[model samples]
Target: MHEINWLPFWLTIKLASITTFLLLLIGILLSYYLAYNRHKINTIIEALLSLPLVLPPTVLGFYLLILFNKQGLIGTLWYKIFNKQLVFHFEGLVVASVIYSLPMMVHPLTAGFRSVPKNLIEASFTLGKSRLETLIRVILPNMKASILTGIVLSFAHTVGEFGVAVMVGGNIEGETRVVSIAIYSAVESMDYKTAHIYALILFFMSFLTLLALYFLNKKWKPYDKA
Candidate 1:
Protein backbone atom coordinates (compact mmCIF):
# COMPACT_ATOMS: atom_id res chain seq x y z
CA MET A 1 0.00 0.00 0.00
CA HIS A 2 1.90 3.04 -1.23
CA GLU A 3 0.83 6.05 0.78
CA ILE A 4 -0.95 8.22 -1.76
CA ASN A 5 -0.86 11.97 -1.76
CA TRP A 6 -4.56 12.72 -1.60
CA LEU A 7 -3.98 16.45 -1.71
CA PRO A 8 -3.39 16.62 -5.46
CA PHE A 9 -6.40 14.41 -6.09
CA TRP A 10 -8.69 16.57 -4.02
CA LEU A 11 -7.31 19.78 -5.47
CA THR A 12 -7.84 18.46 -8.97
CA ILE A 13 -11.40 17.59 -8.12
CA LYS A 14 -11.96 21.04 -6.69
CA LEU A 15 -10.50 22.67 -9.76
CA ALA A 16 -12.55 20.54 -12.08
CA SER A 17 -15.72 21.12 -10.09
CA ILE A 18 -15.34 24.88 -10.01
CA THR A 19 -14.41 24.96 -13.68
CA THR A 20 -17.34 22.76 -14.61
CA PHE A 21 -19.79 24.85 -12.60
CA LEU A 22 -18.67 28.07 -14.25
CA LEU A 23 -18.67 26.44 -17.67
CA LEU A 24 -22.16 25.04 -17.09
CA LEU A 25 -23.51 28.46 -16.23
CA ILE A 26 -21.77 30.29 -19.04
CA GLY A 27 -22.04 27.50 -21.58
CA ILE A 28 -25.77 27.16 -21.09
CA LEU A 29 -26.36 30.83 -21.74
CA LEU A 30 -23.96 30.87 -24.68
CA SER A 31 -25.52 27.79 -26.20
CA TYR A 32 -29.01 29.17 -25.74
CA TYR A 33 -28.09 32.38 -27.44
CA LEU A 34 -26.42 30.55 -30.31
CA ALA A 35 -29.36 28.23 -30.74
CA TYR A 36 -32.03 30.93 -30.69
CA ASN A 37 -30.25 33.84 -32.31
CA ARG A 38 -29.46 34.18 -35.98
CA HIS A 39 -27.42 37.34 -35.79
CA LYS A 40 -24.18 37.53 -37.83
CA ILE A 41 -22.22 37.87 -34.60
CA ASN A 42 -23.62 34.59 -33.34
CA THR A 43 -21.76 32.80 -36.11
CA ILE A 44 -18.49 34.24 -34.90
CA ILE A 45 -19.31 33.32 -31.32
CA GLU A 46 -20.14 29.78 -32.34
CA ALA A 47 -16.91 29.51 -34.30
CA LEU A 48 -14.91 30.56 -31.27
CA LEU A 49 -16.81 28.13 -29.09
CA SER A 50 -15.94 25.29 -31.43
CA LEU A 51 -12.31 26.26 -31.91
CA PRO A 52 -11.06 24.18 -28.98
CA LEU A 53 -12.48 21.07 -30.56
CA VAL A 54 -10.35 21.43 -33.64
CA LEU A 55 -7.23 23.08 -32.21
CA PRO A 56 -4.61 21.04 -30.38
CA PRO A 57 -4.77 21.40 -26.61
CA THR A 58 -1.12 22.33 -26.40
CA VAL A 59 -1.58 25.09 -28.95
CA LEU A 60 -4.57 26.40 -27.06
CA GLY A 61 -2.59 26.31 -23.85
CA PHE A 62 0.31 28.17 -25.46
CA TYR A 63 -2.08 30.84 -26.67
CA LEU A 64 -3.58 31.16 -23.22
CA LEU A 65 -0.09 31.43 -21.74
CA ILE A 66 0.54 34.45 -23.92
CA LEU A 67 -2.91 35.87 -23.38
CA PHE A 68 -2.52 35.76 -19.61
CA ASN A 69 1.04 37.01 -19.55
CA LYS A 70 1.88 40.05 -17.39
CA GLN A 71 1.87 42.50 -20.29
CA GLY A 72 -1.18 41.02 -22.04
CA LEU A 73 -4.31 43.16 -22.33
CA ILE A 74 -6.66 41.56 -19.81
CA GLY A 75 -3.82 40.15 -17.73
CA THR A 76 -2.26 43.58 -17.06
CA LEU A 77 -5.66 45.03 -16.21
CA TRP A 78 -6.52 42.13 -13.91
CA TYR A 79 -3.12 42.23 -12.23
CA LYS A 80 -3.46 45.94 -11.51
CA ILE A 81 -6.99 45.59 -10.16
CA PHE A 82 -6.44 42.45 -8.05
CA ASN A 83 -2.67 42.58 -7.59
CA LYS A 84 -2.53 39.00 -8.80
CA GLN A 85 -1.32 37.12 -11.87
CA LEU A 86 -3.62 34.66 -13.61
CA VAL A 87 -0.74 32.42 -14.62
CA PHE A 88 0.92 29.59 -12.62
CA HIS A 89 -1.95 29.36 -10.12
CA PHE A 90 -5.14 27.43 -9.44
CA GLU A 91 -7.15 30.30 -10.91
CA GLY A 92 -5.13 29.99 -14.12
CA LEU A 93 -5.91 26.30 -14.24
CA VAL A 94 -9.60 27.09 -13.97
CA VAL A 95 -9.42 29.50 -16.88
CA ALA A 96 -7.51 27.03 -19.03
CA SER A 97 -9.84 24.19 -18.14
CA VAL A 98 -12.87 26.32 -18.95
CA ILE A 99 -11.47 27.26 -22.34
CA TYR A 100 -10.34 23.74 -23.15
CA SER A 101 -13.68 22.23 -22.18
CA LEU A 102 -15.97 24.97 -23.45
CA PRO A 103 -16.98 23.03 -26.52
CA MET A 104 -17.70 19.91 -24.48
CA MET A 105 -20.05 21.94 -22.32
CA VAL A 106 -21.52 24.11 -25.06
CA HIS A 107 -22.08 21.68 -27.94
CA PRO A 108 -24.34 19.33 -26.03
CA LEU A 109 -26.27 22.23 -24.56
CA THR A 110 -26.68 23.78 -28.00
CA ALA A 111 -27.92 20.47 -29.35
CA GLY A 112 -30.29 20.15 -26.43
CA PHE A 113 -31.69 23.63 -26.94
CA ARG A 114 -32.16 23.01 -30.62
CA SER A 115 -33.86 19.72 -29.88
CA VAL A 116 -36.66 21.49 -28.04
CA PRO A 117 -39.64 21.71 -30.39
CA LYS A 118 -40.23 25.22 -31.65
CA ASN A 119 -44.01 24.85 -31.38
CA LEU A 120 -43.84 24.16 -27.64
CA ILE A 121 -41.66 27.18 -27.14
CA GLU A 122 -44.01 29.31 -29.18
CA ALA A 123 -46.99 27.97 -27.28
CA SER A 124 -45.44 29.03 -23.99
CA PHE A 125 -44.82 32.53 -25.34
CA THR A 126 -48.38 32.65 -26.70
CA LEU A 127 -49.66 32.38 -23.14
CA GLY A 128 -48.28 35.88 -22.44
CA LYS A 129 -45.00 34.41 -21.20
CA SER A 130 -41.87 36.38 -21.83
CA ARG A 131 -38.96 34.75 -23.66
CA LEU A 132 -37.19 34.27 -20.36
CA GLU A 133 -40.28 32.73 -18.83
CA THR A 134 -40.70 30.43 -21.82
CA LEU A 135 -37.08 29.34 -21.52
CA ILE A 136 -37.40 28.71 -17.78
CA ARG A 137 -40.77 27.00 -17.78
CA VAL A 138 -40.92 25.17 -21.08
CA ILE A 139 -37.79 24.79 -23.22
CA LEU A 140 -35.37 24.20 -20.36
CA PRO A 141 -37.61 21.69 -18.65
CA ASN A 142 -37.81 19.69 -21.84
CA MET A 143 -34.04 19.61 -22.21
CA LYS A 144 -33.09 18.81 -18.63
CA ALA A 145 -31.37 15.61 -19.66
CA SER A 146 -29.29 17.37 -22.29
CA ILE A 147 -28.19 20.00 -19.78
CA LEU A 148 -27.23 17.24 -17.36
CA THR A 149 -25.34 15.49 -20.10
CA GLY A 150 -23.39 18.63 -20.91
CA ILE A 151 -22.47 19.26 -17.26
CA VAL A 152 -21.38 15.68 -16.74
CA LEU A 153 -19.32 15.73 -19.93
CA SER A 154 -17.67 19.00 -18.98
CA PHE A 155 -16.79 17.85 -15.47
CA ALA A 156 -15.45 14.54 -16.73
CA HIS A 157 -13.37 16.20 -19.45
CA THR A 158 -12.03 18.81 -17.07
CA VAL A 159 -11.06 16.16 -14.56
CA GLY A 160 -8.89 14.47 -17.16
CA GLU A 161 -7.42 17.69 -18.58
CA PHE A 162 -3.63 17.62 -18.95
CA GLY A 163 -2.06 19.83 -21.62
CA VAL A 164 -3.83 23.08 -20.73
CA ALA A 165 -3.13 22.64 -17.03
CA VAL A 166 0.52 21.87 -17.60
CA MET A 167 1.09 24.67 -20.07
CA VAL A 168 -0.73 27.31 -18.04
CA GLY A 169 -0.27 26.03 -14.46
CA GLY A 170 3.44 25.02 -14.35
CA ASN A 171 2.52 21.78 -12.51
CA ILE A 172 3.41 23.19 -9.08
CA GLU A 173 2.66 20.77 -6.29
CA GLY A 174 -0.34 21.63 -4.08
CA GLU A 175 -0.92 24.67 -6.26
CA THR A 176 -1.53 23.84 -9.91
CA ARG A 177 -0.57 20.16 -9.90
CA VAL A 178 -3.71 18.33 -10.95
CA VAL A 179 -4.13 14.55 -10.89
CA SER A 180 -3.37 14.10 -14.59
CA ILE A 181 -0.20 16.14 -14.41
CA ALA A 182 0.73 14.37 -11.20
CA ILE A 183 0.27 11.02 -12.88
CA TYR A 184 2.54 12.09 -15.72
CA SER A 185 5.19 13.18 -13.26
CA ALA A 186 4.89 9.93 -11.40
CA VAL A 187 5.29 7.99 -14.62
CA GLU A 188 8.31 9.99 -15.77
CA SER A 189 10.00 9.43 -12.41
CA MET A 190 9.30 5.66 -12.53
CA ASP A 191 6.76 5.85 -9.72
CA TYR A 192 4.67 3.22 -11.48
CA LYS A 193 2.48 2.40 -8.51
CA THR A 194 1.12 5.92 -7.97
CA ALA A 195 0.78 6.55 -11.68
CA HIS A 196 -1.20 3.38 -12.18
CA ILE A 197 -3.36 4.19 -9.19
CA TYR A 198 -4.19 7.66 -10.45
CA ALA A 199 -4.81 6.44 -13.96
CA LEU A 200 -7.19 3.74 -12.77
CA ILE A 201 -8.97 6.18 -10.52
CA LEU A 202 -9.49 8.67 -13.35
CA PHE A 203 -10.63 5.98 -15.78
CA PHE A 204 -13.20 4.47 -13.46
CA MET A 205 -14.47 7.83 -12.22
CA SER A 206 -15.03 9.10 -15.77
CA PHE A 207 -16.73 5.86 -16.79
CA LEU A 208 -19.06 5.91 -13.81
CA THR A 209 -19.95 9.57 -14.28
CA LEU A 210 -20.80 9.00 -17.91
CA LEU A 211 -22.77 5.86 -17.13
CA ALA A 212 -24.83 7.70 -14.54
CA LEU A 213 -25.50 10.53 -16.97
CA TYR A 214 -26.71 8.18 -19.70
CA PHE A 215 -28.96 6.26 -17.35
CA LEU A 216 -30.48 9.46 -16.04
CA ASN A 217 -31.12 10.65 -19.57
CA LYS A 218 -32.68 7.31 -20.46
CA LYS A 219 -35.02 7.60 -17.50
CA TRP A 220 -36.24 10.98 -18.66
CA LYS A 221 -36.52 10.41 -22.42
CA PRO A 222 -39.00 7.55 -22.11
CA TYR A 223 -41.86 10.03 -22.27
CA ASP A 224 -40.18 12.12 -24.96
CA LYS A 225 -40.82 9.61 -27.72
CA ALA A 226 -39.74 10.88 -31.10
Candidate 2:
Protein backbone atom coordinates (compact mmCIF):
# COMPACT_ATOMS: atom_id res chain seq x y z
CA MET A 1 0.00 0.00 0.00
CA HIS A 2 1.21 3.46 -0.83
CA GLU A 3 1.87 5.60 2.22
CA ILE A 4 -0.70 8.40 2.27
CA ASN A 5 0.24 11.93 3.21
CA TRP A 6 -2.43 12.80 5.71
CA LEU A 7 -1.52 16.45 5.97
CA PRO A 8 -3.33 17.27 2.76
CA PHE A 9 -6.45 15.51 3.98
CA TRP A 10 -6.43 17.42 7.24
CA LEU A 11 -5.76 20.68 5.45
CA THR A 12 -8.65 19.99 3.12
CA ILE A 13 -10.94 19.42 6.09
CA LYS A 14 -9.84 22.66 7.73
CA LEU A 15 -10.37 24.59 4.54
CA ALA A 16 -13.81 23.06 4.00
CA SER A 17 -14.88 23.72 7.58
CA ILE A 18 -13.82 27.36 7.48
CA THR A 19 -15.27 27.93 4.04
CA THR A 20 -18.58 26.33 4.98
CA PHE A 21 -18.88 28.44 8.12
CA LEU A 22 -18.27 31.64 6.25
CA LEU A 23 -20.60 30.59 3.48
CA LEU A 24 -23.32 29.79 5.99
CA LEU A 25 -23.30 33.35 7.28
CA ILE A 26 -23.14 34.92 3.88
CA GLY A 27 -25.54 32.45 2.31
CA ILE A 28 -28.17 32.89 4.98
CA LEU A 29 -28.15 36.65 4.63
CA LEU A 30 -28.29 36.50 0.85
CA SER A 31 -30.93 33.82 0.80
CA TYR A 32 -33.06 35.78 3.22
CA TYR A 33 -32.93 38.82 1.00
CA LEU A 34 -33.65 36.83 -2.12
CA ALA A 35 -36.58 35.15 -0.45
CA TYR A 36 -38.24 38.32 0.81
CA ASN A 37 -37.37 40.85 -1.83
CA ARG A 38 -39.38 41.09 -5.02
CA HIS A 39 -37.25 43.52 -6.96
CA LYS A 40 -36.47 42.83 -10.60
CA ILE A 41 -32.77 43.11 -9.90
CA ASN A 42 -32.96 40.08 -7.61
CA THR A 43 -33.07 37.87 -10.68
CA ILE A 44 -29.89 39.50 -11.93
CA ILE A 45 -28.23 39.14 -8.56
CA GLU A 46 -29.18 35.47 -8.33
CA ALA A 47 -27.91 34.79 -11.82
CA LEU A 48 -24.58 36.37 -10.93
CA LEU A 49 -24.32 34.37 -7.75
CA SER A 50 -25.20 31.15 -9.54
CA LEU A 51 -22.62 31.72 -12.29
CA PRO A 52 -20.03 29.69 -10.45
CA LEU A 53 -22.29 26.65 -10.63
CA VAL A 54 -22.07 26.56 -14.41
CA LEU A 55 -18.74 28.22 -15.07
CA PRO A 56 -15.71 26.04 -15.56
CA PRO A 57 -13.53 25.85 -12.45
CA THR A 58 -10.44 26.66 -14.48
CA VAL A 59 -12.13 29.72 -15.88
CA LEU A 60 -13.15 30.92 -12.46
CA GLY A 61 -9.73 30.11 -11.02
CA PHE A 62 -7.94 31.93 -13.81
CA TYR A 63 -9.94 35.08 -13.19
CA LEU A 64 -9.40 34.78 -9.45
CA LEU A 65 -5.67 34.37 -10.02
CA ILE A 66 -5.60 37.56 -12.03
CA LEU A 67 -7.79 39.40 -9.54
CA PHE A 68 -5.62 38.38 -6.62
CA ASN A 69 -2.27 38.83 -8.32
CA LYS A 70 0.12 41.23 -6.65
CA GLN A 71 -0.64 43.89 -9.21
CA GLY A 72 -4.39 43.48 -9.09
CA LEU A 73 -6.87 45.60 -7.12
CA ILE A 74 -7.59 43.19 -4.27
CA GLY A 75 -3.99 42.08 -4.03
CA THR A 76 -2.69 45.65 -4.00
CA LEU A 77 -5.16 46.66 -1.31
CA TRP A 78 -4.43 43.58 0.80
CA TYR A 79 -0.70 44.15 0.48
CA LYS A 80 -1.04 47.78 1.45
CA ILE A 81 -2.97 46.79 4.59
CA PHE A 82 -1.34 43.50 5.64
CA ASN A 83 1.92 43.60 3.63
CA LYS A 84 1.16 40.06 2.47
CA GLN A 85 0.26 38.33 -0.77
CA LEU A 86 -3.18 36.80 -0.95
CA VAL A 87 -2.63 34.35 -3.78
CA PHE A 88 -0.72 31.11 -3.33
CA HIS A 89 -1.75 30.96 0.31
CA PHE A 90 -4.30 29.18 2.49
CA GLU A 91 -6.37 32.36 2.77
CA GLY A 92 -6.71 32.45 -0.99
CA LEU A 93 -7.87 28.85 -0.97
CA VAL A 94 -10.61 29.75 1.49
CA VAL A 95 -11.74 32.67 -0.64
CA ALA A 96 -11.80 30.53 -3.76
CA SER A 97 -13.65 27.73 -2.06
CA VAL A 98 -16.27 30.10 -0.68
CA ILE A 99 -16.92 31.56 -4.09
CA TYR A 100 -16.96 28.16 -5.77
CA SER A 101 -19.25 26.56 -3.24
CA LEU A 102 -21.55 29.52 -2.64
CA PRO A 103 -24.27 28.31 -4.99
CA MET A 104 -24.51 25.01 -3.17
CA MET A 105 -25.18 26.87 0.06
CA VAL A 106 -27.33 29.72 -1.21
CA HIS A 107 -29.59 27.87 -3.62
CA PRO A 108 -30.77 25.37 -1.06
CA LEU A 109 -31.29 28.00 1.62
CA THR A 110 -33.18 30.23 -0.77
CA ALA A 111 -35.52 27.40 -1.59
CA GLY A 112 -35.96 26.64 2.05
CA PHE A 113 -36.74 30.23 2.90
CA ARG A 114 -39.26 30.37 0.08
CA SER A 115 -40.84 27.12 1.19
CA VAL A 116 -41.69 28.75 4.53
CA PRO A 117 -45.38 29.57 4.87
CA LYS A 118 -46.06 33.24 4.24
CA ASN A 119 -48.88 33.30 6.80
CA LEU A 120 -46.57 32.04 9.51
CA ILE A 121 -44.15 34.86 8.79
CA GLU A 122 -47.06 37.28 8.71
CA ALA A 123 -48.29 35.99 12.06
CA SER A 124 -44.84 36.53 13.53
CA PHE A 125 -44.77 40.06 12.15
CA THR A 126 -48.30 40.67 13.37
CA LEU A 127 -47.10 39.76 16.83
CA GLY A 128 -44.58 42.62 16.54
CA LYS A 129 -41.50 40.51 15.85
CA SER A 130 -38.96 42.16 13.60
CA ARG A 131 -37.94 40.68 10.26
CA LEU A 132 -34.71 39.44 11.77
CA GLU A 133 -36.58 37.84 14.64
CA THR A 134 -39.02 36.20 12.30
CA LEU A 135 -36.14 34.90 10.23
CA ILE A 136 -34.43 33.41 13.25
CA ARG A 137 -37.42 32.03 15.12
CA VAL A 138 -39.79 31.14 12.33
CA ILE A 139 -38.20 30.72 8.91
CA LEU A 140 -35.05 28.98 10.06
CA PRO A 141 -36.74 26.59 12.48
CA ASN A 142 -39.02 25.37 9.75
CA MET A 143 -36.20 24.71 7.34
CA LYS A 144 -33.74 22.74 9.41
CA ALA A 145 -33.43 20.11 6.72
CA SER A 146 -32.46 22.64 4.06
CA ILE A 147 -29.93 24.25 6.36
CA LEU A 148 -28.26 20.93 7.06
CA THR A 149 -28.27 20.00 3.40
CA GLY A 150 -26.70 23.33 2.41
CA ILE A 151 -23.98 23.06 5.02
CA VAL A 152 -23.08 19.52 4.07
CA LEU A 153 -23.16 20.29 0.36
CA SER A 154 -20.94 23.31 0.83
CA PHE A 155 -18.38 21.38 2.86
CA ALA A 156 -18.35 18.47 0.46
CA HIS A 157 -18.05 20.76 -2.55
CA THR A 158 -15.17 22.62 -0.97
CA VAL A 159 -13.43 19.37 -0.09
CA GLY A 160 -13.72 18.17 -3.66
CA GLU A 161 -12.32 21.37 -5.14
CA PHE A 162 -9.31 20.96 -7.40
CA GLY A 163 -8.91 23.54 -10.16
CA VAL A 164 -9.79 26.58 -8.05
CA ALA A 165 -7.69 25.43 -5.11
CA VAL A 166 -4.71 24.76 -7.34
CA MET A 167 -5.07 27.94 -9.33
CA VAL A 168 -5.58 30.21 -6.33
CA GLY A 169 -3.34 28.53 -3.74
CA GLY A 170 -0.82 26.53 -5.78
CA ASN A 171 0.83 23.39 -4.39
CA ILE A 172 2.66 24.63 -1.35
CA GLU A 173 3.11 21.65 0.97
CA GLY A 174 2.09 22.07 4.60
CA GLU A 175 0.45 25.30 3.56
CA THR A 176 -1.87 25.38 0.56
CA ARG A 177 -1.64 21.80 -0.73
CA VAL A 178 -5.14 20.32 -0.17
CA VAL A 179 -6.25 16.75 -0.82
CA SER A 180 -7.58 17.51 -4.30
CA ILE A 181 -4.26 19.00 -5.27
CA ALA A 182 -2.47 16.09 -3.64
CA ILE A 183 -4.52 13.66 -5.69
CA TYR A 184 -3.68 15.53 -8.86
CA SER A 185 -0.02 15.47 -7.94
CA ALA A 186 -0.13 11.77 -7.25
CA VAL A 187 -1.77 11.11 -10.59
CA GLU A 188 0.71 13.31 -12.43
CA SER A 189 3.58 11.39 -10.89
CA MET A 190 1.97 8.08 -12.06
CA ASP A 191 1.48 7.00 -8.47
CA TYR A 192 -1.72 5.10 -9.13
CA LYS A 193 -1.93 3.62 -5.65
CA THR A 194 -1.76 6.98 -3.93
CA ALA A 195 -4.21 8.46 -6.39
CA HIS A 196 -6.58 5.57 -5.86
CA ILE A 197 -6.48 5.97 -2.12
CA TYR A 198 -7.10 9.70 -2.33
CA ALA A 199 -9.91 9.19 -4.82
CA LEU A 200 -11.52 6.56 -2.61
CA ILE A 201 -11.31 8.77 0.45
CA LEU A 202 -12.96 11.70 -1.34
CA PHE A 203 -15.58 9.48 -2.94
CA PHE A 204 -16.57 7.95 0.36
CA MET A 205 -16.52 11.26 2.11
CA SER A 206 -18.82 12.82 -0.49
CA PHE A 207 -21.09 9.80 -0.56
CA LEU A 208 -21.40 9.75 3.20
CA THR A 209 -22.06 13.44 3.31
CA LEU A 210 -24.95 13.17 0.87
CA LEU A 211 -26.23 10.07 2.55
CA ALA A 212 -26.27 11.76 5.91
CA LEU A 213 -28.03 14.74 4.41
CA TYR A 214 -30.77 12.58 2.96
CA PHE A 215 -31.13 10.66 6.19
CA LEU A 216 -31.38 13.81 8.23
CA ASN A 217 -33.88 15.31 5.84
CA LYS A 218 -35.97 12.19 6.17
CA LYS A 219 -35.86 12.42 9.93
CA TRP A 220 -36.72 16.10 9.79
CA LYS A 221 -39.50 15.51 7.28
CA PRO A 222 -42.14 15.09 9.94
CA TYR A 223 -41.07 18.26 11.73
CA ASP A 224 -41.27 20.21 8.49
CA LYS A 225 -44.82 19.02 7.97
CA ALA A 226 -45.78 20.14 11.43
Which numbered prediction scores highest in lDDT against the true structure? 2
> Over the full model, what C-alpha lDDT does candidate 2 score relative to the true structure?
0.91
TM of each candidate vs. truth:
0.94, 0.95
Q: Model 2, clash count?
A: 0
The residue pairs found clashing in candidate 1 are: none
Off by over 4 Å in 2: none
- Candidate 1 regions with alpha-carbon error over 4 angstroms: 223-226
Residues forming the 10-long window of minimal summed lDDT in candidate 1: 217-226
Report the lDDT tens digits of candidate 1 across residue range 20-82: 899988987898889988999987888898898888889999989998879877578769988
> Each candidate's lDDT (Cα)?
0.88, 0.91
Clash pairs (backbone) in predicted model 2: none
Instruction: Give the Å error, residue 56, model 2.
Output: 0.6
